[model samples]
Target: MDQSISSLHMRKLCPNLEREDALDTVLEVPLPEEMFPNRKGGSSSSSTDQDNHYAWLKSQAFNKATDTPPPMLSGRTAELQLLLSVIGSPLIPMPVPFDTAFSNRSVCESSIQASTAKYILQQYIAATGGQAALTSVQSMYVVGKVRMSSSEFHMGNDNSSAAAAVPPSITRNGKSEIGGFVLWQKNPELWFFELIMAGCKMSAGCNGKLAWRQSCSEKSHASRGPPRPLRRSLQGLDPRSTANLFVDAVCIGEKIINDEECFILKLEVSPNVLKSRSASSFDIIRHTVWGYFSQRTGLLMQLEDSHLLRMKSGCSRISASTQISCKSINNDSSIFWETFMESIIDDYRYIDGINIAHNGRTVVTLFRYGEGSINHKRRLEECWTIEEADFNLHGLAMDSFLPPSDLKVDCD
Candidate 1:
C-alpha cells in the first residue's frame, strides 16, 4: 500500500488521532506478527480486525480525556450538597421553654414508657447542658470535615450466569472523598449550610419564609414538604432540638449497641405531615425516626430513621405540541425506593459546657426496586468530625440566611 494512502486510512479509522502523528508515526514494519503476536492469524481478516480494535482503543482514550467527568464522580457534587443539608446544618432551637411541657405531663397520667422516656430526656438535657445554658444561646456556628462515599449492591438472588460473571462497578472496598462544611443558625427556622467537595460547592439555606438549595452550574430549587427541622440538628449537634423531637416519644425498648445499653425512643411522622410532603408524582409511604440514648450517660449514642417513597411514572401527558400518545401509569403498583440511615455517635467532648459529638459515623442503605424488577441496594457512608463550634455568634444575622436569588420558589 502507498505510505501516504496508509496514513490517510489510519486517520480515517480513528477520528481523534492527531494529523501529524497519524502521518509521521507510521512505521514500515519488518514483521507485523512479531509486534502483535496476539493476532489470531497472519491473514487479511486478522490484520484488519486488529487495526480496527487499536483504532477504537485510541478513540476511547481521546474521548475520555475530553469528556465530562464520570457520572459517579459528578453525582457526588449533588450528594455532598444533600449531605451538608441533612447532617451538616445546625438547626435553630425552638424558642419554647423545655420546662413548660415537662411540668404539664403528669407522671401518673402518662404511660410508664412515656414517662420514662421523658425522664430520660430530662437527664439528656442536663448532660447536654442545663436548660438555662441551652436556652441562653440565640445562634450557632459550626465548621466540620467529612469523608463520604456511596456504592450500590444487589439484594436478591439472580441465578443467571451473566449476572454472576458481571460484578458490580463498586467493590467491597472503595475510596472516599474529603470535604469541609460550615453552618450557621438562629432561633426559629433560619439556617445556612455550605459544603465544598471535589471542587464543587453545594449550598442550602432558609430565610424563615423560603428554603432552597443551590449547587454549581445549576439554579436554586425549593425543597419539598412543609418547613421541617434539619435532621443534623438531632445528630448530637443540638441536644435541645433532639430532646424536643422525642419529648412525646415512647420508649419502645432497649438494645445493647457497641457493648453499651441504650434506650430506643421511636417517633413516626403524622399522617397529615406525610400528606403535605407528598406530591402528584411522589408518594411518601412512611417515615419513622428512632433515637438510641445511652442509658449509661443519659446522652444520645445513635440515631436512626427509615423512609419509603413510592414514585409513579407516566402519569402526566405530554404537551399537545409534542403530538405523542401516552398511557396512564398505575400508582398502586409504582416503583418504591426506601432509605435507612443509622449513625453511631462517639467521641463526645464538652464544648462550652455542652456535650457535643465531635466525631461520628453514618451508614446509609438505599433499596430501589420495582414490582417485578431486580432489587438493587446502595450503601452510602459518611464519617464526620466537628472542627470548630461556637454558640451565640457575635454577628450572625437573619439576612445571612436569605434564600438565593435564583431559587425556584414556584415549584410545588
Candidate 2:
C-alpha cells in the first residue's frame, strides 16, 4: 500500500493512536496467538479468516470506545427554562385596599378630626342604638360573625427556611349568640358569646354567679369548659358596667366643638386583667383611645378606636375607625348589614329592630419581631355589618355552658 494510505488505514484501525504514540506502539510482527486465544484455527484458510476477523473486530471496538459523543442536555435545559418561567410569573395580589379615603389625609385639623378615637366610638354606639336606648335595655342579644385572613411574609433571616410558609387565609363564617346581663348597680354588664364556625363551636356564658364555656362541633363533641376570668369580672349589662369596662378605660366625655358634636374617650386596659384573662397561654397588655362623633342628630356619625396590645413575642396594634352616617331604618337595611357580615365579616346576625347598626370596616396590621434583622408584617382590611339583634332577658344556665369533663386531653 502507498505510505500515506497505509498511515490512514492504521489511523482508522487504531482511532486513539496519535502520530507520536503510534510509531512506538504498532507492532510489525504477525498476529499473536494470545490475541485470539478463543479462536479455533490450524489450517491456512482459517489463519487468513482469523486475521480478517481480528481487523474487523479492532475497527468495531475502536469506533465503540473512542468515537462516543458527549451527552445531550436538551431535556434538562428545557426543564430549567420551564422552572424559571413559573417562578418569575406575577404573584396573586393580597387582599388590601387599592384606594382608601384615609390614605390621603393632609397635616391639618380636619384630618385629625376624622381619625380621632372619640369620633369612632360615638358612631359605633349610635349605630347600635341611641345612648338613651342602649342604656334603657336591661339586656341585649347580639348575633354576629367574624372572619380572619392570614398571609406569610419573608422573615429574611438565616434561621428561617429558604421559603417562608404561611397558613392559608381562612374565611370562617359562624353564628355568635351574645347576651349581656346587667351587673354593678345597673351600669356594667356581663357578656356571653356562643360561636359556631367551620364546624367548631365555642360558647361562653358568665354572670356574677359563674362563668363557663361549652364547645360543640363535628370534630369535637359538646363539652363544658371554664369561663375566662375577664368575662367573670365583667359587670352586668348596665351603664355602670359599661362605664367601668369601656368608659373608664377610654375616658368617656362629651364635647361640642364648633357645633360639630364629638365624644372623646381614652382607653387604658389593665395588664393584670389581661394576664388573669389569658391564664397561662399568652400575656397581653392592651390600651386604647376612642373618638365618637354625632351631628346633633341622635344618629352616630363616626367612630374610631386606636388600640395597642403588647405580648411576649411581639406587639399587635390596630386602628379601627368606623363611619356610620347614612341611616336607613327598615327591615331591608338590617338584612343588608346581616348579609354583609355573613359574606365579609361574621357568619351570623341576630335580628334587632328595623335598624341595622353593624355596617363598618376594620383595618388591622400585624408585625412579628425577632432578635436579628428579621421582621414580618401583614395588613388586612375587612368590611363588616350586623344583621339581627334581640334582647335576651332570660339569663343562660351556668351548668349548660360549662366544658365537658371528657375534654381533659392536652390540646398543646
Candidate 3:
C-alpha cells in the first residue's frame, strides 16, 4: 500500500473540534490490526483488508458529502458504509412532545402503576434540576468522546456447536473504536447528532418535523415515524427529553442496580406508531423502553430498551438509509433480530445547578431467532464521557438541524 494513503487516512481521522476544545486534544482511532507486526514479530497479514477500509473511509467524494452534501452518493458503496457503521438503535424515534412527556398521561388515570410511575418521574425532574431550571433553557450542546465495538458472538443451542467459538473478526471483549461526538439540541423534536468513528463520520438529525440519518458515501434516509431523538441524548445529556420519554411509563417495580435501589418505569410503543415506522421490506414488531430512577436520589440511573424486527425473507441487506445503526444480518433464512440496549448513567455532577451525568456505558445485544439451526447472538458496547456542555446558546437555529439535500424520505 502507498504510504501516502495511510498518512492521508491518519489525517482524516482527526476531528475538527471547537477552537476552545481543540487545544492539545486529538481524536484517536484504533489502527487496524494490520498496521502492526504479527504476534510472531512478522508483518501483519491483513494489510489488504485494512487498506480497503482506510481508502473507503477517506474517499474524497464521501468526505466531501459529509462537509457539503455531494450531488450524489451511489449505491455501490452502501454495503461498505453499513459494514463500518453498524449500530443498533430503535427505529420508531421519539414521540412528539406536547406540554411535557410525563404530563400527557391524563388518559391512563385509573392505573395505579401509571400513577406511581408518574410520581417517580416528578421526583426525577426535581432531582436533575427543578422544572424551573430545566424549562429556563431553550437549547444545549455537548461535546463528548466515545469508544464503541462489537464484543462477542456465539451460535445458539440449535446449532451443532456445544459452545460456539468467537469469530476472528470480533474481539471477545468487543474491540473498542475511539471517536468523538458533537450534539446540539433545541428540543426533543429538533436536534442534531454527529459522530466520527474509525475515520468515518455519520450524522442523524431532526429538523423539528423529520428525522434522517446518513453515513459517509451513503444517501440519507428519513426515519419512518415521528421526529426522532438521538438515544445518546437521553443518556443523561438531555433531561427534558429523558423526562418526557418516560412520561407515560408505568412503574413496573424496583431493582437494585450498582448497589442503588431504583424504581423501574416501563413504556411500550403503540401499535400505530410501530406500524407507521414499518416499511414494506421490514416490520418493527415491538419496542419497549424502561427507565430506572434512583429511589434515594430521585434521578435516573439507567435506561434499557428492546426492539424486535422481522424482515422479508431473502432480503438480507440491512437498510443503509437508516441511522448509522443496524449491523449486518444473515440472509440464509427468514429470521427475526431482537436488539436490546442498556445504558448505565453515572458520574453525575451539578452543572449550573443541574445534576447531569457526565459519563455512561451502553451495551447492546442482538439476538437472531425464529429460525431453527441458525440462531446467533452478538454483543456490542459503547463507553462515553462528556467533555463539555453548555446551555442557552444564541446562534443555533433551525438551519443547524436540516437534513441533507439528497435525503430520501422513507414514509409519509
Task: Name the candidate that leads on lDDT.
Answer: 3
Tens digit of per-residue lDDT, candidate 2, span 1-412: 0011112110001123455333222222222222121112211111111112111111111111112312221221111111111111111111111112123334354434334443453454454444555545544443333332323343334453212222222112211211111111111224444432222223444443334333321112211122222221111112112222332223356766436575655444455543443322222334343433344543333333333222221111111232222232111111100000111111212233313345444444444432222344433333333433445333333432344454332221
* Residue 270 Cα positional deviation in candidate 1, in Å, after optimal superposition: 0.4
Per-residue lDDT of model 3, residues 133-213, tens digit only: 887768877877777666445656643332322223332443356766777788546777776554455677889787777
- Give the range of the ten consecutive residues with the poorest summed lDDT in model 3: 57-66
lDDT (Cα atoms) of all candidates against the true structure: 0.59, 0.28, 0.62
What residue runs in model 1 are displaced by over 4 Å at the alpha carbon?
Answer: 1-104, 155-174, 315-329
Query: Model 3 segments beyond 4 Å from truth?
Result: 1-93, 101-108, 157-174, 314-333
Instruction: Report lDDT (Cα) of residue 295, candidate 1.
Output: 88
lDDT of 1 by residue, 96-196 (tens): 23334334467788898888888888888888888877767677777677777766456565667324322443324345656666667787667777665
Full ranking by lDDT: 3, 1, 2
Off by over 4 Å in 2: 1-136, 145-148, 151-162, 165-190, 207-244, 249-263, 274-282, 289-291, 295-356, 380-382, 392-412
Give the higher-lDDT candidate: 1 or 2.
Answer: 1
